[model samples]
Target: MHTPIEGFSKLTKAEKIDWLSENCTTDAEKTKQLLKRYWNANSSVQKIHDEFIENTVSNYYLPFAIAPNFLINNALYAIPMAIEESSVVAAASKAAKFWLDKGGFKTTVLGTEKVGQVHFMYTGNKKKLLQFFETIKASFFEDTKAITQNMKKRGGGIKDLELRDKTDKLANYYQLHCTFETLDAMGANFINSCLEQFSKTLQKEADVYFDFSADEKQLEVVMSILSNYVPNCIVKAEVSCKIKELDEDELSGQKFAEKMLQAIDIAKAETYRAVTHNKGIMNGIDAVVLATGNDFRAVEAGIHAYASKTGEYSSLTHAEIKDGVFRFWIEIPLALGTVGGLTSLHPLVKLSLEILQKPNAEELMQIVAVAGLAQNFAALRSLVTTGIQKGHMKMHLLNMLNQLGATEQEKQQLVAHFKDNAVTNASVKEALEKIQTH
Candidate 1:
């Protein structure tokens, strides 16, 4: 993949499409088929009627432009995100530009290890099962090691094991929590396989029939299928930039920082506000996750659960100003993928990965972390400076213009007019009439 054009805004729609095609691999036929699937139209019929013909699916593909000018950890990156929401890309680009003008975004990613858990439940006496696990802990772990020999060789292995018991007068059950450090891989498939094998070994050793699947319907008590709670492997980064413009506005960096902190505080204090607050961060993360074909739903669930882990829903990121510079930081559970599964299936997902130059899973995670932080900054800046509606409503008006069937020139005039006057159906109708008369 090559660098984007210097002034992409100057190009026509066709030119932009052509430029993207040249810089990155494009399967026009596949894209058309996907769009057709989205439109719920037969590919054969649409091929004859529509300029862009393909199969119909349940979802439509809409492209938004991801602008450049980001300096992350002293490196320049052109982050291209695919999303349908308005202002996300533009807001991120603006935030990145702000950082670049000051200094740059300084970032540091921790390790490349992800945690996977295998849960086990015992149907036998809870005390007996607990004692059995304690007695054979070393042997069981050794067997686990044998299964994950390759991973151990790569400096990753079963890190720890713990037991939790729930007992009452009627019944008792114990849980075996096995934690593994999966290095640079999603590791769910591998971890599950290892757990299945270990479960058999435990059953054989104890001479007890362990009901791996406990039916909650029949028995008043049951065991967990598996807990998706990620291990405490934290990823952290900090971005600091000197805001000379804030000084010019008679706003000391300290005051600006206080304002930003207040906004963040407000976001954390209310679930209503925190929902949109986190959505901004997801705007950046989901795009990258979608492009890589990872399970965005799993990531979302883990992140939201993490956000409320403290018993109060709050923002995962924080911002402040110190010593005439703005500083922002975020730490979140961003379990994502760079390769395997749908990343290898769909053509466009593969193409987006190619444009990213095939970053390893760790690098992909780092970039995702940066995007989340940038998106957070965008949201706060808008809330503090010009209202968020200015940019959001502007993009929305363009979408309305598309629905009105205004020609390119008419669209330009209508956009300019709407900027000065409030937008209404009557205003749109008047513009349409003028276009027809002309």
Candidate 2:
């Protein structure tokens, strides 16, 4: 039997939660924890203090919304995201709806484990340093073995190792890159700790005129710091459908795909265009990263770094029309989490998770990657056809009227007037007074 879908605004909070739980394999306990984190028994002094620091005074709060009509891996899901940008949620929902109307988004994730990089600098011969690290590679693995002992017991570990040497811009300094897998957790702390512990042994074993520091607090021996950039590693997914419904020209998915690919190519060619191009991608990725309490800043850094890894800034996603079907594919560094930190602590975050039904790490990554691809298409479609500012300015006009203290009716009238007269504060004021008196 076919069931009617309810509009998001029509569903109550509890109904929404119930719908999510019924559709996905949500952890009830985690759902409860999320509610408690966002909703308090009493507005206590401590609660106010925490809110002040984490929210209002500190500007930590972010709005979250559920992108509707996602069908991933043959299952229906209302993907949850935390973001501030307009049109992103709407565009994702629209793209997903279009796919759902055809069939649905098909997705696959590599694994649950995430990798973190540890870098070392050398002033000695690059080839010799590489050979030395290779010689003691097993020992280095053993030293960091305890860090992931539990994960190893569960059959996971440092999956690979990579080393790269490049001359600094000044030509006097040498940069050495060491890449290692941290299994799960953001692993920043663990990766840095392992590098610090290994540096002492590395310096003594190899005759390298180098000093390194990962002491967290000190910056003495540090040339540059942090292991936030993730390279080469990719998380990917695709959505495709037959073009049976729409005519070849009116709303052909194939044409849409071609236009999208062209926009991405143009974005790659210019630095200015690449900024907005990447921003559109981040609009989707960062939301999920924040909702899950993953370090979104790190994810952003890694994404941009990976984008430019080929020496040219480019779109992380690609779309096409192949074999009479519309297809979209994306492979980007999505370092996100399902557990730990404020994910378990924050109240609204908990609510957002409940609304999402708490997908596991791999499932979550797949959904986020899909959302990113959808958002990319949305932006490209707008840029290629209607112009980005048209829809955006329309939405902004409503917000502007509301901010001006216009009543609901007055705001509606103001929007109508602004559409004809152009959106300006002076025009808004004139419309406001005309609507107020008449």
Candidate 3:
């Protein structure tokens, strides 16, 4: 059995790798070789990657791709996506091209407010607590004045503060709910710094409040942090055209519009369908989010929370065909920043932002929204017409072949064969076996 080790982080990179390979692998030298093979050719670049995270392991890579012909708000853009999935970029590009002649995507930033909270417990009189909060609310801002100085200069700072009583739900539980406008930065650190200060002030003030009883004076700060549920930081992206113009090669315009609307209705009504439907939207959203070096996980959490905001889980993308026109759109909460965190530090992130024409926070929000809206449009179109697997499986073919250890000639032959044949695991295996036999 392997034993736990201490002071592992104190070891040098080479020593760490050596220890890990020996203790964790069946073939130590091969493990080292595989890890080293992924290192950047330039030592300086490799060193940068090493410092990106702890453990100092070799770099893990994902494909960086571009989807061209995106015309958003009367501007053309070639959006960059970094993802391991194969069909996402292709689908997004296809949708963008489809909408190019139909007035492309139009987007608007709905709001740019974010949220944070300070939770505490005080077994005090509710009315007295409320009065105390009204008196000290100004101090919350005053305490964090230095921290919010730069954000204020940028026209973004504390928006509001409220004292929420949750004593009925959890005894003596209360929250100092706050709202903020961070402008070009995600402002997580700034919001959190301000919240921590507010928490300290709340405890300190409660300790000496004249009206508080001895028990009420016992204010316990639970936690102070930024919330991932940002309903106010929202953006909307949409595409619309005459229903008669919805024509593709095989499907009639009216038929296509009707079928697309029906598919969306089913997705909105059924929970199972809605989950996958929203996931398809996120495929495009997350690709761009990851490429830009923003927190995709935070974006994902906030978006899904927004999806269920209406009491039931449902589709994020909505479709409607009326007045001889077909309209599809999505409005999602996205707290994105274009000027901070890894946006300036990561080389690829900087390049991705540059490719996006150096958009501000609101512009980036619109762009990301367009990506998601385009992706869902492509997915629904395929589902209502030729079906989804045809494109998805075709994109997946190369990965299947690579996994089988097929040579160049075999991959070429199999690629051609699968073009006319159905793609499935058993069929692929059989085709490869037959090719090898010959």
Candidate 4:
């Protein structure tokens, strides 16, 4: 192993590449070439990408694709998705087309509140500490006026603030629990700045208060941060149609509806099934989140935490056939932004937002939730009827063909041959060998 180099971030890009290739790679020239191959040819664009993160090597690329025919809330949109997976965009598109004739998707914005907290420890009497908190409650807002000014002007700012006692959970633990409205911005930096200022105010005021002994004055500030578990920032999307309308040439409408409902029930009852079920939904959600330049990891964390909010990990989508109607819906927590982060920096992100017709945060939330619901419907539909591998493997065929070094002509032939045949590694290989031998 090579010794860790200090000041690695201080190194120039070319120098950084040199050092990494010399120390970390087997074929240094090949490594360097491959890394530079993915770099943007334009200098300014490359510079922007280099500064996006530390230790810039090369730009990693995912296929940027569009899934068309989404009709959301009486408006139509063609969603942009950046992903490498084979069937995700296709599946979402198919679901969208199926529901397009069934009145499309209806969405509701349930809430838009986000949370933050300032934690501190106080080894003093609870009664006097709470009294001191009451005296200084106004100061928290007063001190954050500068930070909140622009946000307030935009109809978004601190919603509420309160003191929380956590002595039972941990000795001397207390928090300034807070909520905010961030509008079109994700508001991580905004919430964090407010919480930190609140902590500063807490310390400054505690030093001057004359309510108690020296022990009470020495309040230890632990940390200040925003919570990713944004249960309050929620959106719901659903599609419904007459139960008789689910009929396909292969499966009857009532049987199809019954199987779809049973699949949802299994996902709810079994944790193993629920995890995979939710993953399928995220396959659609993360693609759009990434395309629109939002924090997929944070979205993922909050959604999963929400899934387990009932203390058992369960399905994110629900279905029912009642009164001769088949309805499938999903409610998920998504904290997204349209004007901040990579929205302005990444060129593709700008195009994605424009493609979505420049949705505000709430509208983006609705679009994202609808994508997830569509993906789940497509997956469940496949599971109950034709089985997953038939379609998944069909989409997967191209990757296998390329991996086997098949030419474009051979690819076309094999694709046609597999049209009425099953797809597997061995089957594709056998088909290719037969073609080669002939």
Candidate 5:
């Protein structure tokens, strides 16, 4: 048992590590040294990271990798990925290369609208509330002009506003349903700032409106925040070629396409298959989103919701064989930023944006959707031909070797051994033990 320390956040980095090591770790010195080992050597760079979050200890690192040969809309790109999972980048790269000559990928931005709401409960008469909302709606926009000015200049801001009544769903509940075009910025701050101001303006004006009864004027303003489920902020990416173009080493093009289509059909019909199918797509989307300093969690939430928009969860990617043309595509909701948040702050993020030639939010949206589609294609291709584990385990072999503390020579030998043999945790361990005993 350990006593809790007060003002843990106020402690110095060294002190925090010391306390954590003493209380939480068996070997305090080892834990302290290990945590400090990940710290940036440059003070300036380290300081930037420290301020990124509270109770800072040390940096957590992930490989910032690239999947090149992606040809989208006639332009070539090498998309950056930041993830820990093995073979995700390799799978994406393989897909990119495979599609390089098949017209690569075609992408389109479907929408750029983001959503937010000011939720409240008013037991007042519905007629009076509706009347009051109509009169006060313009004031909401007027009050948020200062916040929306810069966004408007960029041809993006306050696309729509409406009064929504949800009394039928939840008693006396009402809301200000609002939408905005945030352009290259994810605009959470802008949307929230506007919604908050709308809340203030609504309450103030309601207090002064002449038609309202005493209770009607007592408008309760609930929390105002941006909605993560931005179905309107979506992008579509597609790839297509003749059926003959899908030929793999193990399967003919026709057989591979049929098997892949069958797998996708199951994903569409079954919840379990759909969830895992979408997770693989996220492996690619999230990697690029993280590398570009965008919010992957929001992107993920919105996309999963969109998947169930038809009343049942289903596949994000769609496919068909039309007139001997084999096509696959995905339309996903992705609210992303290229100029704000960590994009301008994190060094690797800035470098990543430059590597992709600095795409705007819409452009970034397309690129991310393509990454997801490419990943799904790679995974389905493998599943239809060689199976997912063979390649995945091969890519994961290095981590397994490291876990066993195998020397360079041992790793080399084992890797060659696994080339003709199946790689598994148990198999690798057995092979390593045999090499050691010999």
Candidate 6:
């Protein structure tokens, strides 16, 4: 039976682990051993990982890899990727190579606006509140001067502030919608600080206003936070080649072009297909995001929201073959930072940025977008020709073999065997068992 302990966080890491193992595990010694196995042998490196978060356990690691031959906007780059998925790096590399001779990927930053909101409730006259907001709108920026000073000096700061009336949806509900430009940083902290200051200023101005009744002036501040749904913080990446040049030895150019268009259309029309389709794209986007130490979860949430912006979840990548040209592309909103958070702190993240030739935030957005576009192109190319499972399962075979405890020699043999044989769980398991028996 587990009981709550007071001040658990106050305990040392070893002490916390001791208490957790004793109460939470069947064998405390075994749990301790298991946790210690993953710890870095270097004490200084271990210490750095420990301070990254609270209640530190052993470090959890993912494979750090690079996909070379990426030519984005006439600049060649070897993009770094940090992910566990076996096929992602391989697929992105393949896409980059395929497009290398086809003019590579061209990218553009459409917008760089990020958003936040301050929510509050007021039961007073809506029209009066609107008028009051108009009169005090400038004060909102004026009040957050201290917070926005550095950001403003850096060519980024509060863009606009507006009061949104939502009484039709919820009684006495309103929002102070705000937008900002954080320059090269993700700006969550900056945006949030400005929003909190705005919330304070809003309530203060409303309270002291010489309005009608006391009820009209009473404003209840709910919450102030940054929004991850930054649709305006968008970038587009694309590749285009003449349809006649789409020739591969396996399939005719016309057939290949037609099949790809049809595939994308299915993804656009079907939710089931679209969900998986978009996930493939994210596998590429997330790898780069993770390698650069950006917020993948926030990026994921904002992207999925954008996918359903048309009232139905659909493909993020679009393909069109017209006017003798085949164009494939993706436009996604990625709120990324090149200067703050883990970008400068994490060693691998710094290395990853260096590997990318040190792109600023806007350029980083374009590169990430290109990674996703390339990945989708490779996936679609495979799906329309050799089929996804054949290549994906082939890439996944080593992972499965390791999971099943295959020896190195056995893995080598199975790798050769599966080159000609279909890779499935049953097939691999049977072959491994047979190899051992022989």
Error of 5 at 10 (Å): 1.8
Question: In terms of TM-score, how similar is model 6 to the real structure?
Answer: 0.97
* Separate clash counts for every candidate: 9, 2, 0, 0, 0, 0
The TM-score that candidate 1 achieves is 0.76
How high is the CA lDDT of each candidate model? 0.67, 0.65, 0.91, 0.94, 0.92, 0.93
lDDT of 5 by residue, 138-253 (tens): 88888988999999999999988888989899987899999999888999999999999998998888778645564444578878999999888889999999999888889888
TM-score of each: 0.76, 0.74, 0.97, 0.97, 0.97, 0.97
The best candidate by lDDT is: 4
**How close is each model in CA RMSD to the real structure?**
11.2, 13.0, 1.4, 1.4, 1.4, 1.5
Clashing pairs in 6: none
lDDT-superior candidate, 1 or 2:
1
RMSD of 4: 1.4
Q: lDDT score, residue 1, model 5? A: 66
lDDT per residue as tens, model 2, 1-438 = 325566844665555555554554367556545644664446663364344332221123467788888888778888778887767788888778867866676777654444444444445556666666678766667776677677567555556555544445533233334454444455566556656655654545553423333432111123323356655446787876664543334346556557766776787688788877888888888887777677888888888888888888877877666687766778877666556656676766667667667766566678878888888777776777777876666667766777778788777666676675655567667778777777
Residue range 114-202, candidate 4, lDDT tens digits: 99999998887788889999999999999999999999999999999988999899988999999999999999999999999999999
Clashing pairs in model 4? none
Candidate 2 residues lying further than 4 Å off, grouped into runs, are 1-59, 110-135, 160-164, 167-178, 204-226, 243-258, 412-430
- Decoy 4 TM-score against native: 0.97
Error of 3 at 266 (Å): 1.4
**Model 1: per-residue lDDT, tens digit, 29-136?**
555444445542564533333333232122456683555787766777777687888778888888788778666676555644445433444455556666766887
Q: Flag regions of model 4 displaced more than 4 Å.
A: 210-218
Cα-based lDDT at residue 283, candidate 3: 95
**Candidate scoring better on TM-score of 2 and 5:** 5
